[model samples]
Target chain A: MMSTVLAMAAKDLRLLVRDRGGLFFTLAFPFLVAIFFGSIFSGGSGEPRQLQILVVDEDGSEGSSLFVESLDRSEALSVELSSRVEAVEQVRRGKSVAYVALLPGFGASLSHPFAGSPPRAELGVDPARGAEAGILQGLLTQFAAERLQDAFGDPSGLQENARSGLQAIELSGATGPQAEGLKRLLTEVDRFATTQDTADGQEPRSGGQGGGFKLEPIRIEKASIIVAKNGPPNAYAISFPQGILWGILGCTAAFGLSLVSERTSGTLVRLQSAPIGRGQILLGKALACFFACSVVSVALVIFGTLAFGLAPSSWGKVAVAIACAAMAFSGIMMFLATLGKTERAVSGVAWASLLIMAMLGGGMIPLFVMPGWMQTLSNISPVKWSILAMEGALWRGFGWDEMLLPCVVLLLVGSVGLLLGTKLFRWPNA
Target chain B: MIRLAGLTKKFGERFAVRSLDLDVPRGEVFGLLGPNGAGKTTTLSLMMGLLEPDAGVVDIAESGPPTDVGVRRKMGLAPQALALYQELTGRENLRFFGRIQGLSGTQLDERVDHGLEFVGLTPRANDLVAQYSGGMQRRLNLAAAILHEPQVLLLDEPTVGVDPQSRNHIFDNIEALKAQGRTIVYSTHYMEEAERLCDRVGILDQGELLALGGVNELIEAHGGLGVLTITTEAGEVRSIETENPVIALADWNRSELETVRSFEMERPGLERVFLNLTGRTLRDT
Candidate 1:
């Protein structure tokens, strides 16, 4: 029995290779789907989209420009510098999610550091977009902290200046060591204020803090992370598996069609007369289909990873995933073959159902972009489980246990399909 | 030897083969003669164990039943349609069937070679079945069935729609199998073919066996008369049936009939027997 089954599978594999149409659907079409879908999702950037924000610098000072530049450094936010009027009009017209304005004298506030009045920055958000509003508001505070840190670079120096400014405000200045500390701290502040004025292209007032105590301002120290915070997001990792599922769908359909073909061609009748059980014959054919689907799946994975740069994080899990998925689809093919008695009927119904599953399962569209309910409904599609298993094995970093759910679901579904198909299958023209 | 006792099959309310009883002794060529819609194919299917009998049993030699693997191993069947993977070469098809029949290695290769050569397809063994002519495909189908060399060969209209050359080739193979003392039960819609090859013939129609006997027995029991005919110079023709054509012609001449232009005799065979029994021509059905 085992030998017969192997012989049957070998025959089917040979036929698959020689059949151009079958090979196209099982192998080539998958890559086409992957390439096309990957291109669409990536938009040539190969990265997921980022949150957008507009920055309106009302002050036109060095401090305001520095703050906007800091916001630009964040990975999550994409900031566009615009005029206050244009920013306001853009946000009001629903063109931008929100905008920030840095008022005049914002640059001068840097001179006193923590001791002076806080920098005046206004964040305007659209009331209609509550999610965007909250996100932009949180990002504003983070940007503000980063801006302050870069501007001073010397935290202890800023704190000392702040203490001296407070003492000057109180008058009756400190005596002894504290008096000298205040004197030197005030001089640092005076120097910072001079730098600010110079940076703004304005003349420094000679008597701003008793004149001659102020030293010449040096360059403000800056530090930044020169490397990327994250790696490039590959759309092929997601699309390739979905494309492979398309091939699985095609493979299943071909298997389904084979049952019908056997009947029409009188091969089923011949097998019936052979010294074999009915279950054995059906199983042999189904095993052959399982092989076809698995071979096509592995081939698609290799092609996708090589040609399209879709790398699976764990090849072992990928092996298990493809096995389960192939079995599931093979069972589905048998079940589909049972639906219609003739080849034409079986193929028609199988393709229609498979296409629907593929569409819902993220073959044609990413599930992330789908509506919440559609995503939930897609749980019923076998293609969904197939793609989930593959993606998890690929970039999703799924371990053996992590990969179990989708594989189990696929195996169970496939087994059920096989059971139903076996139960319903009939000899041709009986 | 194959024996079917009250074998029956039904689909819903209609019976495909109703309580058929048949026995074909070892080394005998038995033909199932029937027309379209007859239960001949159904009976052969039951005998081959391709289908389950709703009512009775099929015994092959001393094997318990037709469905048993031990019995099926000793039986071969060739259906009317070409049962082959068209993409594979003829040799490949033979190898596949040979393996399924439990032949392997050198044994399988030898049998495949023998089958290909027997079918006169040795030269085209490497060509795809799809590329073969209809006649060649039919011959290959025959080869696949007999590769295992079963004791009993059950053929169901294997020559339907086949070219004359292929049909003759298939006929020769069947005859050769019988010469080898294999028990053969053949089924066909053509009465002439049945008469030429069968040692004993069973006529079936509408799921019932109407007649069963050797060619001579059937001709004697159901055969009516030999026809005597004469065409006069005046273009008048007259015909009569009798046990003796010579006596009928003597009577015609004694009756002072006009000068005959030509005369001919027609003999009663299986066709006439079918017509006499069923009141319908063999081709009409």
Candidate 2:
């Protein structure tokens, strides 16, 4: 019995070697698809580019220069020097993100004591760089507050004194209190200047404040992606299932033809007269198909690995999965073969069924993108579970825990198919 | 020897073979003669254990069909259809079937070689069945069936589509097997083959056996002693004019017919016997 099975298997292998079309479909096609998909998905790892700014100082006085210097030190903006006209033109032309224009304070306002209004800086920004503009505005406001504390001398009284000074200047209608407030603000700025120096001296903020952008730092650490456990996502996972399905489909077509030929030729009648039992004869044929399907599965795995970088971590699991898949597929082929009376009928039905399973079960399309209902529907397809189990072992780095379900499903499906196949199998010319 | 008693087979609502009784003794070739759909193949299937009989039992030697592994080991069968693989070479097919029949290693090699030699396909043994001519394929098919050298050989129309030369070769091989004391049950629609080769013939029609007897005995009992045809130089062809053409033809002188190119006479062959018994030629449905 062993010899019979082996002999039939050997014969099937020989036939496979002779069939170039079968080889291409079972092996080459899957490897090619894997390579194609791998390349497409390869670039999913790396971080996204920072904004540049320019500051223009028109007033040349201590206050204008200090404010300009503060803006230049900001982490969010990379500050550079330019004339006010040049800076505005740069921002408008989209070369620099935004321009800071320190207005001419003329220093006289700060020389007075509580006599005039505070000086203000004008910002020229490109609205298109909305995120950068917002960051610049926030930094500018913080810098102003720090400068106010120094000019007022008393931290608690700074806000009130600044406000009262600006109000008096506005009421006088002569810019007297605002000029004094501006002078007082300049005197306070000198005191706040020391804090900037201290923080800068401390840790050299590597572009300051945790690398500028407020969101968590995006670091793309590259590691090999396993779509399944125990292996890298590669062609073998896809092709192995396809090979099993096609191998069985091919066997069905061939065996069905052989059966019809035998009946038409009358050999079934002759075999009937022989001493061998029908069970033995059927067993021999089924064994032949099973062996053939296994050969095809192995070939697909080997070539798929070589061509598409499919590497399974565990050979033992892969072998088991292939065996179960092959046996189940062979059973399906035999059962289908028995159902049809003519070779043409068998071929048509078998090919149609194979295509449907292939398409639905990730043979032609990845199951990841399949709709939820379709994914659930795939449970009934042996191709789906076979592919899942094989891929899980090879690409998904699946341990026994992850692998158990698919394997069990495959085994159950195989047993059912084999039982049905054997029961339904018919002898030609009987 | 093979024995089938009260063997019956049914297909849905119809009985293909009904309570068939048969005995094929050791060392003799028995022919199961029938027209199309006469349950000849069905009976052969029952004997081979390829089908379960609706009733009765099939025994090969002393073993029942169901648990007759020993009997199976001693049987060789050439199915009515071509059973050899088309993709494999003649030798490979023989070896494969030989292995299935329990021959292995050097034993398998020897059996394969012997079977190929017996079928006169030794020269084409390496050629794929697909590459062989129709007659060559038919011969190879026969070789595969007999690779195990069984005690009982079952052949179902083993020479169906072969040329006359190949048919003769097949006949010679069967005769050699018979001479070696192999029990043979041969089925064919060719009445002449049955008449020439079989020691006893069982005639079947419409799933029932019409008659079963030796060639001479059958003709004597059912066909009125046989027929003789004589052709003369007057461009006239006629069967011998007598109540018993067998007696008249035995006394005809070839030299007396000076204008006759050739004249031949013989006992009624299986074809004539079949027509006499069933009112139709074996080939005429």
Q: How do the residues A243-286 of candidate 1 rate in per-residue lDDT, one tens digit apiece?
A: 88888888888878877888888888888888877687778778
TM per model? 0.77, 0.67
Tell me the tens digit of each residue's lDDT in model 2 across A255-366. 5445455455555554444445556655666676667666666766776677657677677878877777776676666666666777677677777887787778766665
- Model 2 off-target regions past 4 Å? A35-307, A311-317, A320-324, B12-15, B225-240, B243-267
Docking class of 1: medium
List the RMSD of every prediction in angstroms.
Answer: 10.7, 15.7
CA lDDT, every prediction?
0.77, 0.66
Q: State the displacement of the C-alpha of residue A151, model 2, in Å, after optimal TM-score superposition.
A: 30
- Evaluated on the second chain alone, the candidates' TM-scores are 0.95, 0.88
- Give me the runs in candidate 1 sitting further than 4 Å from their true place: A44-233, B250-256
B1-285: candidate 2 lDDT, tens digit per residue: 788888889999898998788888889899999888888888887777777788999888776673377777777778766776677788887876776677788998888889888988899899988899888888887887777778888888888888998999999999998999999999999878898899999998877878899987887776654445667667677665355664565556534643544455565667767777789888898
